[model samples]
Target chain A: IPVLALGIGSPTWAVEAAHERGSLIVSLVGAPAHAESAIRAGADLLVAQGTDAGGHTGPIGTFSLVPQVVDVAAGRPVLAAGGVATGRHLAAALALGAEGVWMGTAFLASVDARPSGSVLDKLLAAGPGDTVVSRSDSGKTLRMLRSAWSDEWEAPEAPTPLSMPYQDILIGDLLGQILRHEVAPLVHEAAGQGVAHLTAQEPVAEIMGRLVREADQVLADLGTTRSASPASIRPAT
Target chain B: IPVLALGIGSPTWAVEAAHERGSLIVSLVGAPAHAESAIRAGADLLVAQGTDAGGHTGPIGTFSLVPQVVDVAAGRPVLAAGGVATGRHLAAALALGAEGVWMGTAFLASVDARPSGSVLDKLLAAGPGDTVVSRSDSGKTLRMLRSAWSDEWEAPEAPTPLSMPYQDILIGDLLGQILRHEVAPLVHEAAGQGVAHLTAQEPVAEIMGRLVREADQVLADLGTTRSASPASIRPAT
Candidate 1:
């Protein structure tokens, strides 16, 4: 199995441990600099997760981050993540030079994911504009569906979210309470901007089939279409 | 001239005025709701400007925003904006259903743009990570090269930036003085995340030619490449 390491800090110990077991080390990154550090830590593959991702993301957007990480990945395969929910997004990721895509939010609503009732409801109703990135949940910046919980934290009288473990510890009890009690207005979940596209909870197999089929058609059309010509797109520049 | 209406608010008056003069109306939107409103107001064309843009951008990223806006723009042509500086970006925009792209930051460093000395220096040196969106400049969120001005405004002691027009008038004198004095540390310019690709100040013609050539090659290769197959990209799901 390939051990996936979080891309935020040095993962020397995890890399060494994975190597000891003869397993490949996959690392996540949000920037070119992070890609460099992951490579230095002996990561075999890279996942460039942009700010459009659901939880604990960096500032770079997927469109710009993929190419930059690919340029510095030293031939390692780079997977694009964040705001990726459709075949068009897959095609765009390939166009941006990513070897593949690492989707999170798309699968979150899948039946296999088994999301909580409140989380599933919010995910189905949310659009791209309905989500916000805030430190209110995890102390670290997290992109999540907006709810009364977020609003309360964003209030002028609210205290600043503490860093990392402290914030997690402080809110641990309240988070459990809200979830167990099913506090309708306070219930929320991490989601990407692509939440706009996930309107149903389907099986993983169907979602995969649809995505692959759509991407194949899009790629095929793009190759032969006159609209892809430089002449037709000249107005862009 | 086609009147371009800001999509943040209702543009009924601008639409009526443009119609009166027999001019087509173009509108800039950052979300699907804005696209609907712009279309309702009779926009002839739509430009989706995402959070990755330089000045006064909304929260949506270009990748997610383009397709969403396209879905609601009726039959009007939709142009993608923000984080669009290269041919690859142009291809991605098309994949996302945009008719073309409306780029801003790429040209900021071009010889034809004639950016001021301080602005040019900062633009050429800035990478994607070097920019931060802040309300310090125009009292509206603007992505710009991080500078002493932004740092000062972000400090705990600093007062909150007022809304537009009023904030513009308030800081008008200081902004003039800073520019006139050429304060090296405080000098900054509005730029997008794509600034990483603009390392030199070249002619606009060269930039345009390169972008077209690169995009043409990418699209052409994509048509026949084995890498575009669904089997090759199955890991994406």
Candidate 2:
């Protein structure tokens, strides 16, 4: 096994069981207290998810969450996630004290991603502001495309969305119909704000190569302190 | 002036005028398109302000926003802001293609901060989840502490807060009274999610020294790729 890990927001009975079973537990934390608790619960790793992330995310941003989790983790590895799409994000994550990065948005633009039909077209063209976190489904925050359906659901006159299974069931048929008809404006997509960087639909290998090269360049730049000082800011003779 | 730059979100009438005076205008943008416009509007530098910042911020996270801004900035310098409270954050910003970083929350715990009474005590103890973005005044979103006032205003049953001047006037007296009484839970404090990192009150010089030392250490670590080979991930001969 190549280091199997479980991803969870809370440490439950299963987490300790997983630890005992020799599986590494990767606890996801949004708050600093959760980071502490995750470490206390015997997690081998921590993933800090920020508000700008896709699918489900919490109140803080990745820039704020990673450092806090790394501090609480002490020496344990902490992976930075949410809004990481390009190679520069990997470099940024490492600089933030993360051992690695976890990203879901970049692959959506890759040929291998399982997003159906013309979804990649939409994802590739969308800008950074196109995603929003709303309680339109399951009465819980989810980061997805800013569709008309989401906008209507978030409108002042709309009723509060029901919780969990009931809300999922309630919205299922509408989602199906929208996708079935390819109603672009009503479609919901689990894309992070980093979707803004997707320029063309390329292979996973191409993406990986670019990411590694960019990260390497960033490291080289850091070693040299790459900015040139303006003569005005230089010490006067 | 060494470099006369304007800090603003909108393209004010004075921006072009300042450019005419041979000053390097610096505009703050959250979206990539905004970066493009700021450049077209005679800005010589761009500051990417992510949503993790206090006072005013945008929807994207710093990790995602920085590279995007840098890409669109062309030859212009780009600075990253929001949730930058440590040397690690500065390193992260630089890795994301920023020339520098802008910070606010770190100074709140410094001796120079103007917080009265035991406000600094509470700030030092608060975690990453302590701040929230609420539409309390100006009808514009502002990042601040999760106080009773914000909670009450954000509650579902609460009436829509008035806009701008009216809103400020409406909440002014209440805020003044809360400050006068030092009602800890009701006082609105502008702090970013990075408040979790604040541990003690120190001098500005001390903070700067530690930040420089930590940044140097981070750069050195990057040059070396500081990570031990895991036994589990070792290649079998």
Query: Could you say which candidate leads in DockQ?
Result: 2
Instruction: Encode model 2's per-residue lDDT on A1-237: one tens digit a residue.
Output: 424344435455766676566666777776677888777677777788777688777878898889888888887878899988777788889889998888788888788776666687778778888998887865678888888888999897898888876888998888888888888878778878888878888888898898888888888778778344532221111
RMSD of each: 3.5, 3.6
| Model 1, position A49: C-alpha lDDT score | 89
Q: After superposition, how far is residue B44 of candidate 1 from its true place, in Å?
A: 1.2
TM-score of predicted structure 1:
0.93
Q: lDDT tens string, model 1, B124-198?
A: 889879889999878888888899999999998999999987788898788878878889899888888999989
Per-residue lDDT value at A215 in model 1: 80
Model 2 lDDT at residue B127: 74
* lDDT (tens digit, per residue) of candidate 2 on B73-182: 87577888889888899889989888887778888878988677657867887777788887785456778877788899988799887876688788878778888899
Reference contacts reproduced by model 2: 0.65
* lDDT per residue as tens, model 1, A180-199: 88898999888889999999
Show the lowest summed lDDT stretch of 10 residues, model 2 chain A: A228-237
DockQ of each: 0.42, 0.51
Positional deviation of residue A97's Cα in model 1 after best superposition, in angstroms? 0.6
